[model samples]
Target: MPYFAVLYDYAPGSDPLREHHRAAHRAYLNETDHGTVAVVATGPWSDGEPGALLVVSAPGPGELHAMLDRDPFRLHGAVAQRRIRSWTPVTGPWA
Candidate 1:
């Protein structure tokens, strides 16, 4: 398995929609069967930005993207963009 650093950029002025679907979103994250994918860490940006970062493990980018597509936030149009990149944690707890 490989790891990926996923960044979710929220759509402009979609706060209300995000709030409306927040519980569902969290539930999805907590309860979904991601198959080979494993969510390592996930949370919203605390720097006054409307976005989130999720570090996960999957077989590849395609599978990761497919899994993310099921996210409540993404399905409900709360996310404007998603950036996925390969990540290698050579040190720290993740290493």
Candidate 2:
């Protein structure tokens, strides 16, 4: 199964928003299961940075979009840019 990598670039100084949405965001990720086809690994892009990476898995773009639509940030209009791309892993757990 192919995977997808979605990068989210949040606006600067959005801590309060992030804090408020933390639980909901995490819950949203948990609700969308990656199973064997997908996995989500997230963390700050850098110290005090507002960027995050939302790694996902699916067969195609449609599936990816559907998943993104359910994300808490999207629902609350807090996400800045949501970039989606198809990924081919040459090595790692999935390999």
Q: For model 1, where is the 10-residue window of minimal lDDT?
A: 27-36
The count of residue-pair clashes in candidate 2 stands at: 0
lDDT of 1 by residue, 41-82 (tens): 999999989899999988999889889999999999999999
Question: Which candidate ranks first by TM-score, i.e. highest?
Answer: 1
What stretches of model 2 exceed 4 Å from their correct place? 32-37
lDDT value, residue 72 of candidate 1: 94
Tens digit of lDDT per residue, candidate 2, span 35-95? 3335557666877566778667777887778777777777776777888877788899765
Winning model by lDDT: 1
